[model samples]
Target: MKNDRGNSSGSKSWGMMALFLITGAVLGGILGEFAANSSFLTGVAPYLVKQFPIFDLPPVTVNLYVIKFVLGFALYPNLMSILGIIAAIVLFRRF
Candidate 1:
């Protein structure tokens, strides 16, 4: 008899990647904002404080047989967020 099992490392899901990126982006943005506010990192402050094109999804209202739902999502990407994303990619690859 042969053992059956999927590759442990290859089994990582998309959700994990999303979580990692999101966490990194939020933390990096917070740190960047704080750094910019303190006027210490003025050199890179412009890049840290500025956000690129924001992604806004219009709210969706749906009613189905006495059920109602509303959902929406938005993404605000900044330089720090971009850096965080790159870090995430590097981390994902290393794992």
Candidate 2:
């Protein structure tokens, strides 16, 4: 009975970790898309402009689609999984 309980608890933890990872991937992809498309970084652009005052300050171009693709395909999933593992380890240690 104790062994069965442990197995069930472990499975539950795994399921929760999977859910967390999926959520993180979706959020990261959305953020990457926003980062790529929006001129939201314009405020920071001036700082770079100041650093290179002599050169013409061209606007920073982020390709939202490319960012979306990369994050969706490569980055987000991996990053989320790693983060989830780290979090699980930390929480387990604390407990």
Candidate 3:
């Protein structure tokens, strides 16, 4: 009924939000990398160079006779990249 329709729309909204977040993260990362290498952007490059979660954590690694697995996680945020995420959130809320 109406409730079901509402639930369907909610799920779609969630999907859209996920897509937006992923897009923002990827775009931000790309910009950060570019800034790091491009001397022209030196003024803003420092902000983009900052890697968040500044501390190191040991990655989980498992090795077996026939297989090996490694899992790692980190959050590195630079100024413009963080702004990108904020912009994404703003867009998400507005839309």
Candidate 4:
């Protein structure tokens, strides 16, 4: 019975973890931007602010004479974003 309860909650926990990770990445990116502009951290700003594209889905267009639909996806993870993901995992585990 205890094992069954754990399994059921695991799915929800995974969802929450993803949410936290995304939130952390966004917040960290914003912070990274500010840090990049600050004079005090100029030495390390360049490294932290650099962005590398992990994946980029070419835009696909569907035209039907009257309208068109475009779809695409991309992932560019910077150093700060990676840090954010790690921080998010740590925070989630702590809670």
lDDT of 3 by residue, 27-46 (tens): 88788888888989888787
- TM-score, candidate 4, is 0.82
Candidate 4 lDDT over residue span 2-93, tens digit each: 35647554343778889999988988898899999999999999999899999999999999999999999999978898899899989987
lDDT string for model 1 (14-93, tens) is 88789888887887788778878876688878878688768899899998969999999888788887887788878976
lDDT at residue 14 of model 1 (Cα atoms): 80
Model 3 segments beyond 4 Å from truth?
A: 1-15, 35-41, 54-56
Deviation in angstroms for 75 in model 3?
A: 1.3
| lDDT comparison, 1 vs 3, better candidate | 1
After TM-score superposition, the amount by which residue 48's alpha carbon in candidate 2 deviates from its true location, in angstroms, is 18
How should the candidates be ordered by lDDT, best one leading?
4, 1, 3, 2
Which residues of candidate 1, in runs, are more than 4 Å off? 1-9, 61-70
lDDT of 4 at 70: 97
Model 1 worst lDDT run, 10 consecutive residues: 1-10
Full-model lDDT for every candidate: 0.78, 0.46, 0.74, 0.87
* Candidate 4: segments with Cα more than 4 A from true spot: 1-12
TM-score comparison, 2 vs 4, better candidate: 4
Q: Which is the winner by TM-score between candidate 1 and candidate 4?
A: 4
Checking candidate 2 for backbone clashes, the offending pairs are none
- Pairs of residues at least 3 apart in sequence or in different chains that clash in candidate 3: 52-76
